[model samples]
Target: MGKITEFSEFAEAVKIANELVAQSAVAISARKMGHRALTVHAKPSASFAPGPSQEKIAAALAPNASLLKEDPLPGPATPIHDAVLARPSRLATPAPKGSQAAKDGIYRGDKLANALYAMCQRGGFSGALIVDDNGLPLAVHQSPVPEEAIGAFAIVLGTALAKAGKLLGQHNAENISIDINYTEKIVLRRFMLGQSPGYLLVICPQEVDERGEVELSIEQIAQILKRA
Candidate 1:
């Protein structure tokens, strides 16, 4: 009797799936190419801040203020997503000159990553992109962003988001941005001077709302990266 019931359920699901696919095909053909058709709110939030409905849980991406460090035991994942400084077991190398690519008085790629880890810790952000002054990618991790997506974003995307904040104008340019999906995220941020004059690319899990975080974080990080 249980087997018979399971088969019945499977058949019903397949029937619905076929019908939906047929409907979707018709909708696609009628829709404009690259046209986003999602319904918009009557009045999108006037405030520059992301809508209140989309804020991440405060503690989710809270900053790591703990002074105590964790023991670096080898983990299954590679250096890609793991914190480079904190993990002792991995063969992490020192960041070289121009590797960080931040502007004067700003922070480095690692520092930016730490800041983001503090802000959007809810979970979806999985990686980041640390770039240099020239908008070159230095380090990247866990992000689904293709290498091809990097070029246009370097100056154009950075400048556009800067209108949302002051960070973009601080150093004349920023090299990083973030892309957030439902359960995954990537931070494309710039990191500035010290030993490295480039950015730090970070990839992280998507724990917060991607739209809000992506807009705010990119502008801030870009400016900070040039200064770093």
Candidate 2:
């Protein structure tokens, strides 16, 4: 009787445990189904509306169309006036023919000095001097040293060179170069004004074209002398 009682209690306990397990499984299944239903209903659905058409956009901006339009291109530039385009002269008017100024010795001397200055400027000379055959300075321009001394020496050198040329059976030396130092030189140019011989002594670098400058100086001097 005791063994049978023990067996019956064990069977009763197992049946209660089985029923509790089944109830727990059914509760878990119901919770999972509730979670899935809540998830499906909680999410928001995405929806899109159509954008405005081109015609609507144009109508909206019609009020500002004038501001948005580009400015018209500038018209062709006006032609410059002849008087406006003309450059002003800087030179003084010359004295009229046979005028008192033209006849004045002082005026002629000034003109001769101007001619010498122009020659020096054009040939890049350190100085220029015009001397008569008697070794007298007629005009001087931008002289670095004493013009009178240079004039005297130039005449002596020109005479010596002319003598040397005649000895060699050559014409009178028209152009004579004397090297003063390594970088500087003196060019003595012989030219004729009327029947008298004239001298031009120029101090410049050794590399300058002495002959060319001399010829140009001769032409300028001739013009001034003729005018006088």
Candidate 3:
């Protein structure tokens, strides 16, 4: 009886081990099948034959050969409708050659401001202002710095340069430049506005030379002041 019981226990243990081994084998086979399914599904099926030959492709495109020659493939997409093609472009036109005031032969404070604004836009200056000798801003356009502070500083610098030039027995300074940094500088151009000394102060990049713009601005300012 004891031998029979031991034989039975050993047989049961072997059966369990064999069952575990079979389950492990089945799991590995299932994992391999899953990976193969994913790989097979991820790629185009091999059952599909290759594309048409060049001769067949040419035959297919022969009907539209003239169109293909005139306008190649991958050109701009066609507009949805004739109206879409006919619609006027919304792109902004270039700034006018000169200010409206100058063209109309009308000069006023607002017109002067507009002219300055146009000048700054054309010249690409950071800011510009027309100031009196007392350092008061007459017209300002897109002033990057405080108008009053810059106006006052422009007057002070211009006065200092003028005094220095006079002391050396030279002509009064007409243009005074103050370097703010290596990249930017302030330019002061002295002009006479009906017997009153007015200054055109422009802040621009150091490399930009806007002498023509400055001169034009001076002329415009003189005309505006005279008319005012």
TM-score of each: 0.29, 0.52, 0.51
Model 1: CA > 4 A from native: 1-107, 132-135, 139-208
Which residue pairs come into collision in candidate 2? none
Model 2: per-residue Cα lDDT over 82-183, one tens digit each: 211232311333556788865672355456667766666566565667767766666665444334445556677778767877797667668788766566
Error of 1 at 123 (Å): 5.3
Using lDDT as the measure, name the better of candidate 1 and candidate 2: 2
For candidate 2, the TM-score is 0.52
Lowest lDDT sum, 10 consecutive residues, model 2, at 39-48
Alpha-carbon lDDT, every model: 0.40, 0.57, 0.59
lDDT per residue as tens, model 1, 167-207: 44555453343433343333444434556444444444434
Best prediction by lDDT: 3
- Report the number of backbone clashes for model 2: 0
Clashes in each model (backbone N, CA, C under 3 Å)?
55, 0, 0
